[model samples]
Each structure stands twice: as structure tokens, then as C-alpha cells.
Target: MRIEKHPILTFERGKEIYFIFDGKRIKAFEGETIAAALHADGIIKYNTSPKLHRPRGLFCAVGHCSSCLMTVNGVPNTRICVTRAKEGMIVHSQNPRGDLND
Candidate 1:
């Protein structure tokens, strides 16, 4: 569920758009980050831990952490938390630490 109202913040959204996540179409807005859109669409698992292979999700929304890394349009290790969601963009969940040569 989106936070429509807050005591100290305001939200301004852009036009509606759609992106591919793991071969599934996800609804999003132009200005929202991929992680935000995924979260809004009820997708919480972004990746997995490198060693333990545990599920990972959004940790830092400001692009300062690796917890939100994923593959976007064939580019691996993309920080979806800071990358803006675009129409028809392809996103995929990474495998463990992610592959840079992908």
C-alpha cells in the first residue's frame, strides 16, 4: 500500500508506466525508482545474500547500499532503489552477488 498522506512529507507522482520484472509486467510511475515501484506492486525480494543466499530487499533508498541491486536492461548490479522506472524497461532479480559481465 502506498503512503498517500504524511504529517511531514508530500508525494508528487508522475505519469503511469509499466516495466517488465522477471518477465512480469509491473505498473509504475515515471518518477518513481524501480525498487519503489516493485515494492508498491508487492514485490519485496530484490536479490539474495552473496554467501548465505538469503533474500534481500530495499535497504537504502538513496543509492548508498547494495541490498537493492538487480539487473536492469541486461546491466547487472543496478541499484534499483535510485534508478528511475521507465516504460518497457526489463528488470531481473540477481543471482547472489550478481554478474558484472551479464
Candidate 2:
């Protein structure tokens, strides 16, 4: 979900990248945030709201809100929007209290 063409702006795509999402291999571009990469791969939902387990997604692309929090390599509360996606990294949706692996 990135602008393919812009009148005033341009994007120079980096090298092809790969990461692990929910135990599946997802292809993406280097230098893109985890959320952006995931969104490009059709992953919109990040985590469920605490307590209610209500689904949440990209409310704020910036890391100022809790909507995009997820587990990255076993660490909880990671703001994927600002976290660059690295090759071979493990990413999983976070639950109410912690990572799915926790």
C-alpha cells in the first residue's frame, strides 16, 4: 500500500527483503517499517485491544499510539510502524498481556 506514482514525490525502493510472520515467509523491501511491509503484504490487523480483545490496526502510522503494537522477535509492545523490517526477523501479533510466544 504505497504510492506507485506521485506528482511531487518519488520513492526509491531498496533491495528485496524477507521476514517471518506468523511462521510464514513474507517478502518486503528493505528500509520499510514492519507495519508498512506487513500492510504491503495484506496484513492490516496488528493486535487486539487489551481486555476486550477487539481488533485494532493502523490508526496512527507514527509510533504515538497503541494500535500498532505487536511482538517482534519475542519482544512485546513493539511499534511496528517505526520499526524497520529486518531480514529473517520474527514478527507475530501480540495478545492482551504479551507476545503470542510468551
Candidate 3:
């Protein structure tokens, strides 16, 4: 599921693309952020806390905080909140140990 309509920002519909997450294929709109796409898909837990292992979501829409960190296309320490989603881009949640392919 994706955000069909947004309140503030007008969603510019873009080309469809497929990406793999946890071995499952998912669709994302072109030029959308990975965090936005995931959030639209009902995925809030982007990463776990390093110490307490508490699930973390998007705190700041910008890339100031480390809350919305995820692995993008096998790259670790990716800030999904700011990173724009592209066609065929893969996004994975980071574990407590900062592992993406766990």
C-alpha cells in the first residue's frame, strides 16, 4: 500500500519500480524517499536502538537524526529519511547490531 494522497505535499506520481526487502518484492514510486515508501507500506520500524534494541521510526523528516536509518541496496548506515528512492532500489531494516542482511 502507498500514499495515494498527501495532505501538505502534492505527490508527484512517478514511474513504478520493484525492489527486494527481506526477500520480498516491493514497489516504490520514482523520486520518493525510501522512508516514505516504507511508511506508506505500513513499515515504521526502520532500525533498532543499538543499546536497548528498541524499534525506531522516522523522527525528523530531514536527515538530522539517526532514527530513520536503513540499508539501501546493500549499503549500510544509510539515512532513508533524506535519501530519495529510485527505481529498483532495495531497502532493508537495520537490526540492533546494525546488520542489514540479518
lDDT of 3: 0.77
- When 1 and 3 are scored with TM-score, the better candidate is 1
For each candidate, the alpha-carbon lDDT, in order, equals 0.89, 0.85, 0.77
Candidate 1 C-alpha lDDT tens digits along 53-91 = 898899979999889888898898899999999999999
The per-residue C-alpha lDDT of model 1 at residue 91 equals: 93
Identify the runs in model 3 with alpha carbons over 4 angstroms from their true place.
1-10, 97-102
Q: Would you estimate the TM-scores of all the predictions? A: 0.88, 0.88, 0.79
Clashing pairs in 1: none
Model 1 misses residue 95 by how many Å? 0.7
**RMSD of model 2 against the true structure:** 2.0
- Residue-level lDDT of model 3, residues 7-57, one tens digit each, is 898767788876766566667778777777777778777677888988788
* Model 1 alpha-carbon miss at residue 76, Å: 0.5
Clashing pairs in 3: none
Better model by lDDT, 2 or 3? 2
